[model samples]
Target: MTSRRSFIKATTLASAGLLIRPSALLPVSSRYIGLQLYTVRDAMQQNAAGTLQRVAGLGYNAVEGATYTGTQQFYGMNAKAFAALLKQQGLVMPSSHYRLGAEKMKGADVKGTMLHGWDKAVDDAATVGIQYMVCAFLSPQERGNPDHYKQLAADFNKAGETCKKAGIQFCYHNHDFEFQQQNGQYPYDILLHDTDAGLVKMEMDIYWVTRAGMDPVKLMNEHRGRFPLWHVKDMDSTPERKFTEVGSGTINFKNIFKHAQEAGLKYFFVEEDKCPGDPFASIAKSIGYIKKNLV
Candidate 1:
C-alpha cells in the first residue's frame, strides 16, 4: 500500500546507511579501555585472581597479559582456566607479551625446531583468545650488534608466520634502546623496513618513543596501518622525566589519539612500569583521567 516513490526513497536511505562504518556512529568515548597486567605485576604475582577482580571493579573491560612462555601459565593459571576467569570478570585479553627465546633466533628455516615450546605457547595463546602475541623485549645478549637486529627482524617474520597459522598476529614492543643509533642507522628502522608488513605488525610504546626524543605522530604518518596496538603510558614534566599516570603527565594523549586511524590503532593498554605508591591507586587515577579527558 506504500507509494512507489516512498519505497524507493527508503531503499536509497538504507543503502546509504550501509556505506557508513558502524564504528563511526559510536561516540569515541565508548571505546574499550585495556590495562596491561604488568602495571600491577607485584599484586598479580601475589594474587592474580584477586588483583584481576579488583581490575574489573576499577572499570577495565580488557587486559593485556605479561606472563607467558617462561611460566607456561597466565599469572599461575593455565590457558583454559585463565580464559574462563577473564570471561567471569567480563574481560578479554586481546594481546599478551611473550619473549622470543634463544631458539627462535636461529632464523626461519630452523624456527620450528630451534624454538622449543613455541608451538605450545602459540596454542595456549590461541586457546586464551589472544589476538596478538607480542615480542616484549630483546635482552642485551640478543641485541648486541647490528647483525643481531637484522636476524631479529627475520625471526619476527617467522614468528608472525607461525601466529598467522593460529589465527593471531605477531607484534614487537619497543623501548628506547631500539632508537639508539649504531654506525648511523637506528635498529628500529632496520626492523620496520625489513619485516613483512602482512606477517608482522608493531605495538608502539608512546612513552618509550617520547623518552627516545622521537615523535609518535610522525611515526604513525610514516607507517600507516602498521601499528594496531599501543602502550599508553605518560611521562612527567620534570627534567628527569619519570613515569606518571596517564593525563597527569605532560604527554599530549589527546593529540596522539587524534591520529589513531593513521596508526591503525584497534586497542591501547595502559601501563606504568614504575609507580610511587600503590599501583592500584595509580591505575585508578590514570583510567579516571583517560575516561574524562583523553578516552
Candidate 2:
C-alpha cells in the first residue's frame, strides 16, 4: 500500500534514525520501564556494573539512583563515570534520589545534599542525564512538627528554584507518614499547596499513597501534571499488606496506567524496599507483568 514517494520518505527517515514505529509513537509511560536501583541494593553494593548489565538484560530502559553517598558518588562511581556506564548498557538515568541532610554523620562534611552543597548536587545530576532530583525521605527527627513541614515547604521552593535554574525539576518523594494529620492538616497537603507547582513537583509513591488509604487516580485528578514521577510497586493481599511483585498484588495498575497522561507521568521506577528471595527475580516478575498487561 506504500506509494513510491512515501516509501522513499520512510527509507530516509529510517536511515536517519528518525523513523517512528507504532510503539515509538505511543505514550512514553506506556513503553518505557525504569528501575529504582534500591530494589537491588545489595547487588548494586556488591557490583554496580555487573548488576546494571543484568538489569539491562531484563529490559529496563532507565534507572533511578537511591544512594548518592556522602562522598557525592552514585553507588561508587562519580556522575560522569556512572552516566557512561548507564549509556553502555543502553539505559538512561532520568531521576536520582537526594536527601535533605537531616541524617548527616557527626562532624562530617557532606557535599551534594539539600541542606549543603545543593547546587553542586544539581550540577552533578545534570551531568548524569537526570531530569529530576528528588528529596527522597524525611527522617523521624525531621517530622512531627507542623512548623517543620512549613519550613520544609519554604526550603523545597528554594531548592526548586535552584533546580529550575539548572534545567531540572525538583520533586518530593513521599511515604505514608506524609498523609498523617499534623495540626488537622496533612503535611503532604502543605507541601502540595505551598510550593510552586511549576517548580516543585511531586513524585507520588503509589504504594505509599494506597497504603495511606488514598486513591492514586483521584490524587492525580486533583493535581494533574504536578506528578511526573511515580514509584510503581504493589501491595500483597495478606493482612500484613506487604510489598509484592507488580501484577501479583491487588493494585489495579491497568486502570491506574490508563490515567498516566492525566498524571503527567514521564517516568516511573519499579521499587520494592523489601523482596523475598533474589531481588533480580522480583524485578523480572514486575517488569514482565508491566510489559504484558499494565503498560
Candidate 3:
C-alpha cells in the first residue's frame, strides 16, 4: 500500500538504525550489579570520583543515578561527559533515575532547559551504555484512578518503545503512594494489570515496601519474574520509620535474596532515604554486611 516516497522514508529509517553499533545494543557483562548512588549522597557530594573508587574497593561493580552538587557538572553534567567519568573510575552506570516531571511542566519546550532532553536522554543513556533508563518517581497528579493508571501504562509503554529503539528498558520505581487505594482499586494494581510487563518493569525499594506493610518476597512470588531490580535497604527498629544500614534491622534479606533468581533480578542497588550519621560510612557498613551476608 506504500508509495515509492513512503518506502524510501522507511528505508532511510532502517538505515539510520543500522548505523548504530552492536555495543549500543547489549551490555558487556551481565553479572555486575549496581547501587543507586543517592544512598551515599553525602560522600558523592563531597568527592565524586573518590567515592566511586571506594565503592569499587568494596564488592560493588556498578552504580546508578547522577549528581555532583558541589563538584564539576555533578547533577547537571551532560550524559557523554558523565559516562566517560564513570568509565574512567572503572564503574558501570547500568541504570539511573530521571524524575518524570509533571505533564504541564514537561512539554517539549521545557526540555534541555528546565527539564532534560527527551530524545537526547535516550541518546545519552545509550552513549553512556546503560541497559536500563529509569523513570524514577511519579508526581502527585498522576497517582489516582484506574483511568489515570491506564494512561500511565500507555505512557510507560510508549517510553519503552522509545527505549527499545535505543536498546534499553524502562522501569518504574515505587514508594508508598502508588499503593494508595482509589476507586476500590489500587493504582499500582491497575499499572501492574494494565501495563505491558515486557515494556514496563519494577525497581522495588525493600524498605519502603516493608514500610507500606507489604511483603517483598510475597510480591515477588505473586509477580513471578516481573521484578528485575531492587533497592536494598533496611528499616530502623524504632516505633518511627527510619533508614538503617543493611543487616542492622530486622529485614530477612537472606530469604529475599534467595528469591532473586525466581524474580529474574537483573540488578540491585542500595538506597537509604536518610542516614543518621555519615551516609558514606553507612553505605560502607551496608555494603560490608551485604558482601558478608546477602551476596
Against the reference, the lDDT scores of all candidates come to 0.82, 0.84, 0.70
Q: Weakest 10 consecutive residues, lDDT, candidate 1? A: 105-114
For candidate 2, report its TM-score.
0.90
How does each model score on TM-score? 0.87, 0.90, 0.82
Candidate numbers sorted by lDDT from highest down: 2, 1, 3
Taking the tens digit of each residue's C-alpha lDDT, what string does model 1 give over 1-295?
Answer: 1243234323433432322354663333245789999999999999888888999999898899998765688888988798778877878788999887773444622221215567777777766777788988877856866788888889889888877776678999999999999988999999999999988999999999999999999999999988889999999989989999999888899999888888888788999999989999999998999888876
Candidate 1 segments exceeding 4 Å error = 1-29, 103-114
Per-residue error (Å), model 3, residue 273: 1.7
Per-residue lDDT over 234-283 for candidate 2, one digit per residue giving the tens place of the 0 to 100 score: 99999999999998898999899888878888889999999978999999
> What are the per-model C-alpha RMSD values against the true structure?
9.7, 8.0, 6.9
lDDT of 3 at 6: 35
* Sliding window of 10 residues with minimal summed lDDT for model 3: 106-115
Better of 1 and 3 by lDDT: 1
Give residue 129's lDDT in candidate 1 (0 to 100).
74
